[model samples]
Target: MSIEQSWNRITRTLAEHAPATAKELLPPAAEADVRAVEDVLGQRLPVELFEWWTSCGGGLHPVLPHGYIPYRPIGSASAWREWTRRHGDGPQKGSAAGLPGAGWHSRFVPIATDGGGYDLAVDLRPGPLHGCLFAFSHQWGVAYPPEWSSLTAMLGGVADALETGGPVGRYHAETTRGGMLVWKL
Candidate 1:
């Protein structure tokens, strides 16, 4: 299936569950938002990325909790802005729930796309097992533990039933750090 198709599936699933914990709803990164993405970096997204995004869907760190946010470079900017305005402070020392909760990185990477929203990227390679990486728009990750291992592995699961063709995964990251890296993959 295409990324949009997969996103529809995920969103449908979430809708059924309704009010899934903040960790359950995976986000969306779509080709429809290509204009928005292009606006952000002032460069067209690589064809490979478009194909990957249309096919692989958004970035979902499988190891994260169900409520964990996925990488969504598309959505309502106000939502993310509101989220930050209300909970801009990272996380506390011990708090686990709510915005600016403990272990979460502060500030989301701002992307200027056509339809503008946020981009949340998750790195799967490297060590330290698995952990939340990108957070833009209304989505961000916490520095908890990993149950998966790598972001690539998580993408693999989403593509298990995917048809042939298209890029292997969704958006890519430009750097590492604990914030939302630019979409390079």
Candidate 2:
């Protein structure tokens, strides 16, 4: 399914079974806002990421419950701030998952946050894996192999898990008595 279709499914499920979380979903981002961020970063967003932002800017809280790790979507502004915060911080040195770059690179645009330090980002770096999704742990650095292939894949996995009670990576989707979506390992 298309990213928009997959996201619609997720939102529909959330609205029906997790209204509290659904209510926190942000509206579509303005084109100008997105372009401004791109201008500052000097990088054009991947088409898929731009498409997603046009459909939903981000979320106001950690309402999404099906990422490889806990995360909430972040808007363009938040993404820029995150990129700036980690810019030119030197290469991440440690045993990594054999991924590109020394660790974090300027092209790794964060799209979601765990609210602690970990972020879910799209690798905009020039490579075969460009536009793929990966976990960015401040302590652990960039993860190799990526959590999902793309934003569309991530949303499709989430929508499938929500609809079928299946798994998105290792996460099992659940809804609380308080109408919030939660993921259980």
Candidate 3:
């Protein structure tokens, strides 16, 4: 299914199972906002990500019960720049330096965060890994091999888990609060 269809399923499930949480879903982002993010980043966001932002602006959406806050337009641009400064090459790499192959690069753009320090990013580098979803931790570094091949696939997994009481991609269903299910590591 398309990301929109998958997200719709997730929202329907949330509305049925956790009405209050569903109410927290943010509205779609404006086209101008999305364009501004691209302009700032000097890169075009992957189509799936663009669709996601245009359909559902990044924030507290019920679909990601794991607290993965997808960055808003400006938030995304700023985050990529910040992560690049801290983890990308150069002397500013700082603490992230000398980590035995653990560091961020320019092509890896921050998409969502667990509201802690962990982030889910899109690998925009060329070649096979392009468009893949990666899990990045400030404490541990990027989880190699990625978490999902595409954002659409990841969301599809989440929808499947919600519908079947199963795992959501690499994460497992942890608990439920007020009828809202939460996924965890």
Candidate 4:
């Protein structure tokens, strides 16, 4: 299904099963805000990610929790800059050279985190990896190949897992107080 369809399914499920948590989602991002992020990053965000921000502005939601804080466009830019500053160089020379390490590539923009210093990011660099979704950890580095081809697919998988009680890879569907469904690791 399309990203809009996936978003609809996700929101509908959340409203039905976890209304309270759904209410916590941030307002849709403004176009200007998205532009601001692009200005900061010095490159445009992927179409899918732009669509996602415009449709559902990043915020706390039933499917994503604290460590998984979704980034508002501006927030994402700032966080990327900060992370680069703190971890620009690798711990061991050549150990993480040219790979995703302390100084992550400029093309990768963090979209969310696992609350344990790991991040879910969008790879915006050119070539084959463009638009791919990745999972990165501060300690372990990039988690192999791309996890999803696009943000739409990733969100769709999350929606599917929420609807079927199926696993979304390492995460599982979990319900908390007030019958709210969330993805838990």
Please, what's the RMSD in Å of model 3?
4.4
Report lDDT (CA) for all predictions: 0.36, 0.68, 0.71, 0.69
- Per-residue alpha-carbon lDDT of model 4 for 1-185, expressed as tens digits? 77667777878887887787677778889999988888888887767878877877877643553236677777787877866666545323433212343446666788876667677777776655567777667555443357777777788887887788787767886778886666666
Best by TM-score: 3
TM-scores for the candidates: 0.32, 0.83, 0.84, 0.82
Q: Which stretches of candidate 4 lie over 4 Å from their true place?
A: 65-67, 89-102, 138-144
Off by over 4 Å in 3: 61-66, 90-101, 139-143, 174-177
Deviation from native of the Cα of residue 178 in model 4, angstroms: 2.7
Cα lDDT tens digits, model 3, 1-185, are 88888878877877787676677677789989998888877888878888888877776642463568767777778877877777766222232312224677766777787778777777776666567877677555554457777889888888888778888765765436666556676
* Strongest candidate by lDDT: 3
Q: Per model, how many backbone clashes are there?
A: 17, 0, 0, 2
The TM-score, computed over Cα atoms with residue i paired to residue i, of candidate 4 is 0.82
lDDT of candidate 1 over 1-185, digit per residue (tens): 34345445434433333223213333435556644645543445444345434543333332122223333455323334554465456555333322222332322332212123333333222234322234333334332333233333444433331222223345322212432222333
Model 2: which ten-residue window has the lowest total lDDT? 65-74
